[model samples]
Target: MRLPGPHWPSVAGRARADAGPLLLAALVVAVVTVLAAAIPPLLSATADAAVRDAVRRDGGDLQVHSRMEDDGGPSASRIRHPRLAESVDDFRARATEELGPGLRAAVHPPVATVISPTLKITDGSVLRTFQLAYLSREGGPAVTWITGGPPEPTGSETASVPYGAPPWPVQVGLSEADAAALQLRPGAEIPLADDQGNVKKVQVSGIFRPSDSADPAWRLAPALLKPVAGADGRGSTRFAGLLSRESLPDARLAFGPDELRRTAWFTPDPARLSWDVVPPVAAKVVALKAASGSSGARDGSLKWETRLDGVLRDVSAQVEAAFAQASLLLVTLLTVAALVLLLAADLLVRRRARPLAAARQRGMSLPVIGGELLLESAVTALLAAAVGLTLAAVITPGVALSGAGAPGPGAAGAVAPGAGLIGAGASGVSWEWIAPVVIVAVLAGPAFGTLTAARATRDRRVPANRSARRWMRDTARLRRAAAELGVLLAAIGAAVALHQRGTGGGVLPASAPALCALAGALMLARALPFGTRVALKRLLRSRRPLAVFGAARAAATSTRVLPLATLVTAAALTTYTLTLAAALGSDPSNALTLAPAPTLGAAVEGGPAAGPLAAGLLRLAWVVGVTLPVLGLLGLALGAAASAPERWQTLTRLRTLGLRSRETRWVAAGELLPPAMLAAVGGPLLGVLLAHLTFGSLSLHLLTGAGPAPAPPWWGIGAVAVAFVVAVAVVVPVEAAVRRRRRLSEVLRAGDG
Candidate 1:
């Protein structure tokens, strides 16, 4: 060119020529990136929904209850005079503050109350005891008066009165049911005497009913609304009457500092909760409980009780188990994706071998050539990853929509609004998984390119003696054996760790299946050559020329470890996915499988937490079912195509000896079929073995609600094997047909060149 300009036109032409491999590289990167980006949001949504459902089911049990009993001790008497109401308020505030911000924001305002010990009721002749309750108006339950208004305190602050003396009585409200059972009405006065013979009279100020009995305010003491039969077996009934907040100070005084029980209840608003806040909230609750019991508490006698921590702990455990299962499946998918990428890269290297060799012969530096390849690959991979991430974010809603009507309440665990590139939920997308996938995709191209270029450009001289060649072969064999042994040991260790630690083992357990597959693949690759050689020897003895040639060709082809590994792993994953789906679907109690009653269906049908898990598993199964076979076939095609040049030269020579094109295809089929058949047969068995090994440690019952993991589904495994074999059978002819189109003259000219 004029002025010796850069060969942009030639580079463009080369790029156009290699569009197939480049596009494939990009597509693989994009797909893996999309998968990586999509998984975290789905898991987050599922976990959040599960936590919400658990919180909802817990109902009032999740309310935090803090109470203190003061026996008129010197310490209690000191705090009683200045107004016990302030002390009660202080306790409520302290409990709220200790819950941490996340939970504090979720809690309903505390309902403070004062409770009196059992005292003899003098109004009724039954000699019963009445429990006095002073419910605060600020955060108390809404009540509708059936007869009279709420209670109000009298002006007197006397702690007690003489047993027979007339005294100012505390005014109290009672529920209609309680009023009827106690034979008392508004304005009726009941005299109660303590164990020490000190007396106090309480008049029924009102008869009322709670507006919502299920409200958290009423849950603090059910006895306040209804009479509780004493556990003494004497059939003694104790009735509780509610006094207004204004009477709380008087009630405290009348009961004496020693006999009063002051309490506060804080209920959480489920709407404000999500899975992400569970651990911290639970920890805070535990801390609050411990602080209440400790001497450092606001009141030395204060005691805190709440099952919220336990409820949240159960939710956390379930979420972790669900995540472990999901991670296991995702890791398998990623491993297979990695293998496919490597196979594609290997194909690309083979395609560029001739041009790369020519450049090296023309005095082009290896680094320069490698850098150019690296640049091209890096650009393609990056662009593909960007497109993939975009597509994942876009299609996430659609994927979620497809499972909208799934059985569980959490089944529609769609990504929350505002989820993007910032965080896990509304704020942004979580990049914990997405970043690694993108990095791998972007680097895969350059790494494979640079390495292949270096290998191709390295100078090599043929071994001069048979002993030298044997030594080299032995060295390579030993290296492969050591690598295989290492993978096997790693797999064993991962399995042990998974078994011991279960879901707590983190991502380490996820690698066991992949490592096991790698070890198996290495062994299969080692065995393939020996098997092919035996076939070749047997064919040579038979006088069938086409069979002999095909066998010889098959025996001569180098062992294809990458393609074999890809196919085996894909098959194993497919088998495992199908088996798991079958087991999950087989559950008789699974809402997904059950049909509603024909004519008398009940009004409410609740699904288990496992519902979302099963839905997710089925979705994953569908993906693995569709994806693995295609990738396996692609690997087979690439492996076959890598040998295209040599195959074409061989076919040309055979054709010169009058071998028919049909017979030449048989030779190609011979080379492809053995490995395909081996993978088809062995992969499912390996998958079943993997399932057996891992399911015991997986605790799948936590998600499936089934008894022990069922045996691997034989029918499904057989079907997967059949489908894989059929796919390879179909691919064989098509590949042979493509090779048949390569004219002998062109192949001959290319060989000469």
Candidate 2:
């Protein structure tokens, strides 16, 4: 339906005439859309960091260890599970296959034994002996072999004492004190004994030192035993004493899998893992436990009890909750954004009404006009969406989700550091992101256009039956009142429910309050036409020409102003309610109490580190709270801008007719500023009131404790209001100056009415 070739200028000219609203609409849509794309990944990244930290601290995501009986300790025969090696190997292989490269597994020696054997080391001559504890790599990560190497010739496969010789000489690692007493250097052959009267001749393969914090059992005595001095003045190695090493049968005496009889730990790579995979990981843990049956069970003699880190379950729940909330709030914000854009579109279409009528008079069909409008909206939506997505990509990573170092996830005052998982998580955009943005942008434009066209067509299709119109009007009024009453009752119910639910650090179900706020904003729209009528009545009584003209214009435009005002009100209330909830939820005292006891069926007790779940919620609240209002303000600004042209033309006429510049500015401000201010100021107040009504003293208490509610950022809100007023006041004179370059006839021709 678009005009072709030479006639295309008219289409382009009409677009330019409505450029202010189009651009403003695009800006509003872009901001909201970008936020929707960016928030989920950011929240997920934040929650992942919390989970990662928990896993790191707890050792791994899951632990499988032997569950020993409490009676003294298990007997030697019972403790030595011959099936342990096979079962562990099977479990590891299966888990690795299931979890893929993302799995990170580590084996830990039993907590009851951090040291291996206290071995008797002796000199060859007369068996001069020193007893000292030995530590292997599995025992002490801090143990550093100082010289020669790993004990040469790790023990052979045979379970008998005085076993077969290793590839190299039998070897043992000794601490400095042990080596000094034995007078043995690295590579020196030393004799060692076990309690079974079995003797093994071994080399002192390495002398090592253990960290101060290593088990005392792993360290040599403070002083070394000295042998009688020889002619060279060095202590003699010759001695006469029996030696032995004390240890249980089947104890893991080597680092290899065959001797690894205790417990094994497995964890997935936190960077690769997400909350969704927790259940499968848990299932693997359960399977491993089941495979390693109880101590005497015939299925498998090895007894393995598993403890998946408690944090996994909690963080998983929290992340899931956060994403759920994010999805809900995202939908709400988008709905508001669509409404704002629709209003702007409607205003733009109204400006084109005269031109459309002129085109129709010249024989242009409705289909052609519809086609051109669709093309315009599609191009605009696509351009705006691209800008929005690009902007989201650049700015999203700066949002901090890693609430680190705060006393758990719910720590009150800690803002998450701006780095950490952002680099690793959701740092980039993919097609999963691009597709939604394009679709929403495309859908938003057509949505607003169709609604606006419906209104315009309805107006043109009005029938000429006065009685029928009266009856229809009355029915519409009754329906509106019933709707308003229903909304009011719903708002009260929601407020009460919110109060009850949100009290004492509980999760606030936001849907009800959000609905209440939306309804309240629409209800507030009723005041606009009444206020405009009264103001017009008073203005008509004034002697001033600007007042009379401005008042008349305001009365004429009240229909357009009311719907925009309602949208502004809803956006403001939603923003304020969300912000208030965020503030309350983020307070340290208000953190949800994580389970203080261990989950059923798990051996370990107590909860994971506090704050991850709470912290994530805080971040969600802050993001939504801050973004919602900005969306509303953008809509408000665009709404104001769309109406500016008609108001400016009136001001220019007043200026030309003999009114002073200041009076013209005043008249322009008088017409435009009230509805914007009322929506902006009233929306937040209405929101807070509704929130308080729903959530009660708990809402207020969460914000401030025993004192007055911490003041809302009124100064910021006021600044926005003042800036809006000043801009409206300034634009009238600025446009008059720009239009001074045009002839008076041109100004007259620009009038929409």
Candidate 3:
């Protein structure tokens, strides 16, 4: 019977020797899992916040109106019918209840009129305004006074006014400019006549000014009720005024039929309102309408208009869509990371093949050997899991970053349901989901290690057959080429499908660049060996000894060019994304880095320079670009280490042949340089081509409005150079380190010529 493998003492020695690579593999798994856990939630939160803010900046969440259509008929001309008033009341109550306390709700009579007041300006020109009246409800705009404070309360307010002294006023507020033009001031009395020629004197209780907030709603509020000379024509200072709900009856007495005919009331325009004040009020408006039931819906002429809800929902959907794209990118990145880790593990396993083979020959069963390796893997996995989970927990809460600059008015005011969106409040990581994440991280390292170790052992057991090996070697190239071609074709097909989907709305597919990058890299890697060999052969014919030797060596090592190619391809993908973003002049990195984490923030900053979806895609692309190359570099390092044993032996032989150490290092450096250089040039070119192919039709106007194609991203070239330099730096040291540890005699005695 075969004996079981020795216990910890025997296994510990081998584990120690291989600890560096094993730990590196674990680290990769840990880091990848941490990033994976953190990214989606963070990106989702950020995108949501950004979209909400953008929508808020435009207006509140929605603009709701219960309106009776005026077909310019005599019936439409009636201003104060009981059915209309009751409908408005019902709509307001229902909207408040249904929309909940989080939303702002207001009731307006759908009344806007061009009122030619009985009062005359100092210049003897009659002043007119486009007048709109809002009922004083639980949530409605206050007629704020910029000067002389608010007017005294009038006993005329009805029960509908819920706050602040019943919201009754016998006076009006005018914009500073309008008041000045009309020679009016605080407490000034102005006479106004109704369509029936009834006249009443209304007091100008205050002179108001606009706030610093650029919210067009509040900024134009003072003037919306008033008239502007520029737009309303230059006969007089067309007055803009603010009036309380209690003043409505008196207003009718002072205004004419022409004014009444021009009036209709509705919720404030979303695009015209401030973000901070719109959402809650809008929700309240919706609730009010729903509560009104058939009262507001009685006639075909009566309609409830709500455009902001759909707009807000669409904006939120954009965020969710961007999250999907970011998730796709994360998946791609993780896949690349997994592939790199597996490659490195395979190399480590292969390096230990001779020891494993000897053990097997000494009566150690495969299962016994496999158990020890499995134990080592388990240990590594546990460590990785702990690190990954810890990191995930710490980082997740901090990732609720805003994709847009800040939460706009929609996120501002009260803690409404709308405030639960991304960037509006702090987001916590769900521990329920974290257990699975930890498990995945734990499994990542061992799964790949065990598979590689099992494969290596099996290969060891197979007896050498030169002809068979020759056939396998020859066919490997063909298989690689076929795989590359297949990938390219599949990427092309996806690109076509993506193109047909149109970029009119929602998030664009992230897979386009990832697939293109993979296909391009693989195709280039597959072709590199043959092309290098052919070119080197041509150089070999020159017959200069050093040149011949270098070219011959390069041609021989061309078989192992995939890792270098992969490194380049990954770098290229990153470059392409950043270049595209830079070309558009919208730096996603700035927004991401500068944005605040989700919190019950004060007031948020301004809108993002880029659209939420656009910024999100760009940010995801940038992150993927930065991270993928790291995986590529790790793969290259493993590839270098895997080839170290053979390289050291070759260098030892050269040293014995009277070549100095410096010359040997140069030869080694040169061996690595060609592939590195080839990848550098090919990688960026492929990336640029793929970018153009996938996003060529995307708005060039994003970069420069209706202008010619903008300049190429020169920064991408710099990135390539940096990546190349880093690759060279990493590769050369690996060679030198391996060289330092080896001696001529050790190599000579180890069965080398």
Candidate 4:
């Protein structure tokens, strides 16, 4: 029953030691990749569930409102409705008292509203405000009121514009974060205009992300379409009216034909579980709508028109989508680790060429050896997969899912092989995400390993001219050449695909294609051997020996740098493109600095002064320092990390050349001079860009003329310091590699062979 010639266990034991570093590196890269992709979605999921649970448990089902008045009261006409309100306090009290346990409602008055203003671009083009509904939050986050995970508010100013349109920044969403990021809370400067008030300037007090039904947001005068700063960077804000509380009514229905029966305007937090709405004249039909696709009224503006027991499908979809994305990323990561193991198996075959040749001489059949190879590959792949999955589970944190990360459950990107999901669509694991991805990854790993082993074994042959082949025509050269070509194509394709997706959206052409890039890199790196480093040595002569060697080795050798560099490149591109787009795409409020020529919602007492007066009340002391840098420290971190390696390598060579470690560090630090300068220019300039864009592209000086200057990213400069320490670490090995040469004994041995 002799089945296999070579023992599978022997192959595993021999290769395991060599695979350790690659495995560790793979683990790190995979973990980081999964985290960056998954955290945002995970955080969003947590918040969404929390909000839904809190709202439903609170017993607030429906809210009926018509409009707001100057004294923070509902418009007179709305008060006439059976369950309508004149004052929010009156409504909150009465609803909790009368409705008892069945319904719960609380209304907070805003100082002013920023009505959908006509949008005029800087290019002198006009954009219509046909669809208008702007959300502007003030003060602190509403999460403080509700005890939950990351509070996912329904809709604070989801955008600067009234309806969905081009955000002033080229491509980014509004900086709809919590209070610590935005810097204000409730009761400060809420808002300026209202359903009845006439005002321009508004204040911010609190933050909330209400659903799309907040028609009252448009009660304030249209804010100017100007450039604004945001949490990420500089972008333009459309109708960026500050979310101030009720100051005075902006307008009222004077004399419409429906006098006692006109349509009513109301604003409710969609994030709330249910709303208690009493239709005009207490009509039975009430509808609801949301931009995120919440449903109630099958009709327009009525996203949901169901009875008291709302379906909540729309809200749930958003949360589940994010959770699914995180989970998928986790699965893909584990799958990638398995692929790495398979790649390792291929390398193991190549490294064991001498041992295999001896086996062949000992009368081992090809099929028997091949079978052993396959079994070993499978075991290794599984082991790596298990370890990777465990790493992923351990590193996951309590993240607040951002809608940005939620591309709806599965990222619709690469699929994992052999993955499985439990349920789907609000109930179970998403089949589409888990099944295909895991299955493909699992099957592909072993198949790939076996195929590569078969091919290498079949192609195994001693060259007719062993001497010429060793230097020029052997399997090593041919294999190295093939690996280089394949990896080049795959990595380039990955880079290209990454560029396309990042510039646009989604992962790659498919999940498999993205993984191909990884496979290609591994294949190329392993196949190329260390010979390529010798070939590329000339390219490093201009730098210090250590740097030159590092560059030569990192560049020419496939295994040394390809995988990590490729990953670093992908991560850099992702972080950079998204950050830059977000920085350039995000916008701040123009109302933060400019006031609207507030006009009454209805016929009012004070005319022009009324608008200014209400606006004036909003400019409070606490409101003085609410700055949001569209491009903040996140940008700095990315920039520094991108350039750290090269700087460190240069310093290493100097240290190896007998310079003081400290001196070498400084020299290495000096290498960062260009990027450091870049960080300097980019940091303050980003601040300037943010302030100007957010406040209508105004000329700026921090703390003196315009406002406070952005604080320099001392941390980025500190990165240079860290780079110096790294240089010392790199110097030792780099010098050894550079000084590497075949000794006379080795050359004589080679000649004899």
Which candidate should be chosen as best, given TM-score against the real structure? 1
| Tens-digit per-residue lDDT, 112-142, candidate 3 | 3223333333333454533333333333344
Q: Which scores higher on lDDT, 1 or 4?
A: 1
**What is the TM-score (0 to 1) of candidate 3?**
0.69
Q: Estimate each model's TM-score.
A: 0.82, 0.64, 0.69, 0.36
Best by lDDT: 1
What is the C-alpha lDDT profile of model 1 across 549-615, one tens digit per residue?
Answer: 7777777774767888888888887777676666656676765523332211111124555555455
For candidate 4, what is the lDDT? 0.32
Kindly report which residue stretches of model 2 are placed more than 4 angstroms away from their true locations once superposed: 1-13, 59-61, 66-261, 267-272, 286-302, 306-309, 391-466, 475-515, 535-555, 561-563, 570-633, 644-659, 690-711, 724-727, 731-753
All candidates in order of lDDT, best leading: 1, 3, 2, 4
As a whole number from 0 to 100, the lDDT of residue 33 in candidate 2 is 52
In order, candidate lDDTs are 0.66, 0.50, 0.53, 0.32
Q: State the displacement of the C-alpha of residue 534, model 1, in Å, after optimal TM-score superposition.
A: 1.1
- How many angstroms is residue 187 displaced in model 1 relative to the true structure, after the best TM-score fit? 1.6
